[model samples]
Target: MKKPKLELDEPQPRKIIRADKAPTEGYSLVVDGHFKSHHDTVEAAEEAGMALKNRYQMLQIQVYDAVTKTRSMIEWPAPV
Candidate 1:
């Protein structure tokens, strides 16, 4: 039997900081699953995430390190 092909749905709006190698940079900042920019360090990427929060009012942010394969999340200004 043959199987059919599958396609994924559109991505949702979100912020992410993660390590990357394809760009030849140290790390990258992504928004809504789209590459936003690259940074020299993860810390710089985190700063970009904060900037996204302040500028775009994003409620949540996710950080991932490809080197360590670890992930974390940041909540922008705890909901009141």
Candidate 2:
């Protein structure tokens, strides 16, 4: 007899302007200065971040490159 799991083991919390770099080997999805998760490629990281960005639209999300120690901000274009 064991209790059923209600949620999967996934990082959902995201947000600011974190300047620190990730220590992991792959690209990291940083939300509001926090490392949410890591991806094998930049495309995957951006895609994941975009999902969150599209939902909230205000959270500051970025993809941190562990090798380059650089981060790129992701955003949606303003409505014309």
TM per candidate comes to: 0.49, 0.67
lDDT of 1 by residue, 1-80 (tens): 88987878978978454334324336555555545566678888888787787877754565556566554554576345
After superposition, which runs of candidate 2 have C-alpha atoms over 4 Å from their true positions? 1-21, 78-80
| Per-residue C-alpha lDDT of model 2 across residues 8-48, encoded as one tens digit per residue | 68886784334464554779988999888878899999889
Count of backbone clashes for each model? 0, 3
lDDT of 1: 0.61
Best model per TM-score: 2
